[model samples]
Target: VNTHGNTDFRNLFSQLIQKPEEDLELDRAALYLAGEEYPEVDVLSHLAQLDAFAAQVSQRVTHETAPANLARAIADYLFGELGFDGNSGRYYSPENSFLNRVLETRTGIPITLSLLFLEVARRLGVRCSGVGLPGHFIVGLDDTGEYLDPFNAGAPLSMEDCRALVDRMSAGSLEWTDQFLEPYTKRDILFRILNNLKAVYMQGREYTKAVGVIQRMSIISPGLPSLYQEQAWCHAEQQEFRLAIGTLEAYLQEAGTPDDSKEVKDQIKGLWSTLSRLN
Candidate 1:
């Protein structure tokens, strides 16, 4: 990646995060995240496509359309007409995590599908938001208190169904809690998307990509000390010892004697010794 391009994206992403929650543009932020891997992505063109989707939906509904009917219409339009569905076969594919790919392929995991649903709903004046369930994600209609599972052909889910979904997804290990159904803020959604990317990159042994995801996470949660540790791990995996040590030091500075301080100090010493031997 070009250093100038990196600086420009950082500044742009930081500005997006600084916006008021109401004004934070989730679609723009999401496309920018996708640009990390697909640097040539045209964000505006994708956004315009979303506009076209909303325009079509507008023709089917009037200003007085009920929220429930509106939700159904959107589900039908997106899933039935567009054929957007979950990519159950390759759930972990990095493509499933990127909005642009999801738009083009009409297949994505729960979060990306839910994001697409939310964006289309947003354009139509619907108060829909993402419900970040453990091991699952869905869209919630703020007006009707209903949840829609975009991954499952936009199936409308009752509260009981949602609880059962959590049970099944976790094999009953996670206890049901009302908090699980709470709507995630735009920033929270962005963080979750990055968190998914971080895992996929790490599992694929793409340490550099994992580090990039962590850097973006830092922009969203600047005071998050654990991010420094995670980034350091990625750097160490890539054999960037000095960079890893600096990251760990920054972790210590932000964490200020976290419980793992002693272990971290030992790790830093070991890295330094390795660096010396290399010299």
Candidate 2:
């Protein structure tokens, strides 16, 4: 990343954490996070592109006033014309987690695609929320409670259909629950997406990349000790023993309680021993 991009990445997280939880611009924040992977990207330009797309969509729907109509227009515009859809072929690819790449390639996993759909819908003045379904993420309209599955060409699905879809995905074993349809807030969505990226990085033995993902997670929720602890583990995986120990110390200092501190102390002891052996 260039100096400007690096600054943007740091500022993005600072702004993300400083904002009141209710007022966070999660969509923009997510795009900024994704921009870190591509230093050449102009993050704000994509936000403008979203605004432009919304304007074009407005032209198409000027005659109609209903939100469902607007939803359909968005689905058609995003899925049909723009051709954004799920990347089923490489289901676990890390590129699927980056918004800039998703925008360029017009493909991503369900959560990222849903983010694009949600943000576009928002820019168009259509209300939307994220649905953190088990094993799949989708979008929901605010007033009507209607759901959109961006992974499936932005197909609209009723609650029962959603249940059925989950059942099929789980081979009929996982039971349906209303909690799955609950609206996921901005931080919740970011956490999930970052976790996805973390998994992909760890699976590829890209420990540094995994640490980067955790860093963003820490930015989103600075109080979360588990995230810092995980970052320490990632550093250890990358054989950065000092970084691992330092991160663990931060976790203990910031978030650990008396008993929890004891546990962390023992873990830190092991990390120090490991570091000694490495040296």
Candidate 3:
């Protein structure tokens, strides 16, 4: 009896750890991944341990300690005692993966972790809020109302640092905007999660699931032109020409004048022409 439970938990953890970050459909995936089996001990017990550790660290932090110092202390606790492997530099969390696994299960992880280090800046108490940034989820510490990223692992960064990180992640081709730095609501965070899922589905050639994710995103962020474009592409791939045309048109209406706009219009016109042929 114990063997079956142990095997179930192992399988669940394996699937979760192995699932690509982009493809995580929290509700559906979590159900499927966690459904197979669980031990008498709750799976979230691991997360609870992290929460307890964070609470202990949070208590020791003060307005006098520098953010960097606090970060180092917490990192040591996490890596040394808690068994989290701090990749080579001891700076960032697990290299390319966003910290969602810790974040999703431990809702307070981001805010608590950020608070533990925010003791450095004396000007004001920093309030931590989660921002679902494109390609990543980050914590924003409101320092006397100024939003700053704490996920850089205690390193103090200017707005330029944020842009540089985006550029690095985008392989230097994309430009960052002021919009990227603006604070996002919890609703925006959920959409970001869905968008991430869409990317994974598209990559895996799971067009239906990609479309479903994009559709959900559109409900939350109806004004985002790129979401419509993605939906159009998904529909086109499935040969749903009329739906694709409608989606492309909607994107064109929202997308303003630019080289990208011209290119998009050309693509839309071509898609429409293709649809006409099919009709």
Q: Please list the Cα RMSD from the true structure of every candidate, rounded to 1 decimal place.
A: 1.9, 2.7, 11.2
Better of 1 and 3 by TM-score: 1
lDDT of 1 by residue, 1-279 (tens): 212125556667778999999999999999888886777889999999999998998899988999989989989999999999999999999999889999999999999999999999999998998999999999999999989999999999999999999999999999999999988999999999999989998999988878888888888888586787888888888789999999888888878788889999999999999889989
Off by over 4 Å in 2: 1-7, 256-259
Measured with C-alpha atoms, the lDDT of residue 71 in candidate 1 is 87
- Writing each residue's lDDT as its tens digit, candidate 2 over 105-187 gives 99999999998888888887888999988888989999888898999999999999899889988888898889889899888
Cα lDDT tens digits for candidate 3, 1-279: 011123453344445434554453232333222232222434355334445666766676776866545554564554344544323342222211223343333212233233322322211233445544445444455543233344434444566666777788688877778777676553444455455556656877777656756655654556676777788788889887777777777676766554467777788788889978978
Where does candidate 2 clash, by residue pair? none
Model 1 spans with C-alpha error above 4 angstroms = 1-5
Give the lowest summed-lDDT range of ten residues in model 1.
1-10
Residue 126 of candidate 3: its Cα lDDT? 30
Candidate with more favorable, higher TM-score: 1 or 2:
1
Candidate no. 1 TM-score: 0.95
lDDT score for candidate 2 against the true structure: 0.83
Candidate 2, residue 268: how far the Cα is off, in Å: 1.4
The lDDT per prediction is 0.89, 0.83, 0.50
